[model samples]
Target: MVSMRSALRTAPALAALLLVLTGCGDSGPAAYGTDDRTITVDHGEKFTLKVPANPELGQNWYLASPRADAGVLKYRGDREDTGDGDGTQFFDFTALSRGKATVKLLFCPYGRCHSADEVASKPVPTATGTPKDSDQEAAYYLYTITVR
Candidate 1:
């Protein structure tokens, strides 16, 4: 029902809008998880480690400091998203130099989280050691990162 002139006028505008929308997406840094035990990145590149954590249920993930080599990787910060009792936690990092670094995360499962001060007081728990003893539900997630 439209005239040729009207269709022609809208065609260019629609194409421009489509091009703009295509270029608006944000491709963030590389993301990893427990399954990705080994990772590599270029110097100065940024990356994040995504873990599942629902603080409302006492599921916590802490960056195990003194584990990763600071000279190679710099810990930036952390962020989280909560929804439907299934939340996600993010640990940000930047590749500082060309070397190898190991990142360790201490996971405190539901009903068993420790304070910052208490993290060092107790021995590091193995990933398989979840609930190994009375009321203590602690585990570790380990990863090796190589920077180039």
Candidate 2:
């Protein structure tokens, strides 16, 4: 019957629509991503690199003002876990070179470089001082990085 055929076709269409709408769940680390790529950032003062909770594949991210010689900053996370929302993770790079700093983020696992499209940068401040420290200066710098 034409009705039966139409019903079958509609079912498949609806199923496809659901999948598209929901999108493939992020099974990897809660890295910054819009669809498939991943993103990481450097908060400036500390070498501890930061990454967005949900990273999309094949997107761009940055760590502002990275050391000219400093290599890519890496992040590790549980593969089987994803949470209610993206959570930020930080890593320390205190001993590394200091100055305007940016960190490189790869698309794949580990430090694998994936071209200019897969990295993000953030500026690292020279120092972070507390108000209680009389020697602390009020000067500070800001940097921005994005991961699509």
Give the TM-scores of the predictions, in the order they appear.
0.74, 0.24
After superposition on all C-alphas, the RMSD of every candidate to the true structure, in Å, is: 4.7, 16.4
- Candidate 2 residues 31-127, lDDT tens each? 3322222223333322334433233322222333232334332222223222454434333343232233333332222233333333334232332
Model 1 residue runs over 4 Å out of place are 1-25, 128-136
Clashing pairs in 1: none
Worst 10 residues of 2 by lDDT: 134-143
lDDT of 1: 0.79
The residue-level lDDT of candidate 2 at 80 comes to: 22
Compared with the true structure, model 1 gives a TM-score of 0.74
Quote the lDDT for 62 in model 2: 35
